[model samples]
Target: MKELIPLRLSILGHPQRLAVFRLLMRRYPDQVPAGEISDALKVKSSTLSSYLSALLQANLVTKTREGTSLRYQVNMETTRETLDSLYLDCCRGRPDLCTSYQQPVAPKERHMTDRKYNVLFLCTGNSARSIFAEAILKSKGQDRFEVYSAGTQPQSSLNPIALEMLKAKGHDTSALRSKHMTEFIGEGAPDFDFVFTVCDQAANEECPTWEGQPISAHWGMPDPVKATGTHAEKSLAFHQAYGVLQHRLQGFAALPFDQLDRISLQNAVDEIAKTSD
Candidate 1:
């Protein structure tokens, strides 16, 4: 039997260091020198050195002395042990809770409890990115998810470019109309199971925000509606936004909703952002 390397998230407490651990895991089985990890994560050498040192101390990662360079690799042995310990500690009764979510169930067979998740997508304008997301999820999740989209400052009409592309993808647009976020509020409104902001929050642009989403994250994408150029260039912007949303939605759709706790659910939603194209 293989011995377990002690795993402690407290040692890699900061988001930056935890990010470094994830980065190394993404490139697992291939050792990454400190310089490469620093460049990829945009952290300074001094700063990255500190993060790496903590990870090493926690035994969450392994280091190789390859001549003058110190290459780093995720300690898979430690990761496996830590996850096993976590499951033992938390999944005493729920076997499905700790099982991997990679194997997605078919729409008809999934969510056997007859639960239909209420999902909301938001942006400053209802026209483009949010619209793209609603259509994508409706198509991908089929009848399993009740998907809706709205804007902080609702537009009187949907973006024509976005509509054109949706039609190109063979998505029906008759039911999708631009609307304000308030419509979902007031009495007798469905409580959203998932809320996502699809606008470019990273640029500090004005995007919608909501409280108590249960599970929420910013799946931010550039506002293709703001793009100015030739028709083809503008179309390209919307196309890229569609690709990013489609990829992220695929991740969201595969999650085992019945098998996750609030902490696990929140982590899964946040991790889906990494799949951004």
Candidate 2:
């Protein structure tokens, strides 16, 4: 007769189950819907539900009733224990491999006593990509970063498509305007930490070196305004550019600025710029 192990111990022994558990760990406390998990992992919903049920039975996940939808979140206490057990098993009694278990660190506080770094976005016309990036980053980055945008040769106005997209995305576009970069070059200009040129021409043009010697980067995105197609096609291009900028900026805000030297930080920013292309 085979010996029976405790349920918690038995669940930990299964590698397939552990993978699902780790997926939840990555999105912890977010209460993912089962359908999203199925879509993200390319698993059939029926099969995924069985796995989720097993996890629930093992107390590794908790399900909450959200109207007609069921939401699943990681049971943190159980998750910590499982991680502790795995760490011990993997280390093989090596103290160097497994340090004392500590509570996971929270995201760093955004409060900076030092003057906030000013970030400037530049392009030729500043009607589309540059405008979208400036608005999105300013709205989403909040207290973590200060942001601005200007054009080498200012446009008559902000792009209507860009303004509509921003409004659709729940961002306030009321205060946004198109302005010339020259306005920012004088003695009273706010010193910038980063100056990102969002178009190839503007990036190539010689400009005054910004005060504070801001780290410069080129994020060359194709101009959505140049799309020669149906209205839907032009709008789609703006949406795509917005998504690319949002993803890169979110990653930028999460960077460990304090821990990295100037060169390393520039490299990291450059790597993020590639994702937009």
Instruction: Give the per-residue lDDT digits (tens) of candidate 2, residues 114-223.
Output: 44667899998988888888888888767766888999887999989889989998988887899899889988887787888877557545567676556667776778
**Error at 240, model 2, angstroms:** 1.2
lDDT of 1: 0.75
Global Cα lDDT for candidate 2: 0.73
Q: What would the TM-scores of all predictions be?
A: 0.58, 0.58
lDDT, residue 162, model 1? 96
What is the clash count of model 1?
0
RMSD per prediction, one decimal? Answer: 8.5, 14.7
Q: Estimate the TM-score for candidate 1.
A: 0.58
Clashing pairs in 2: none
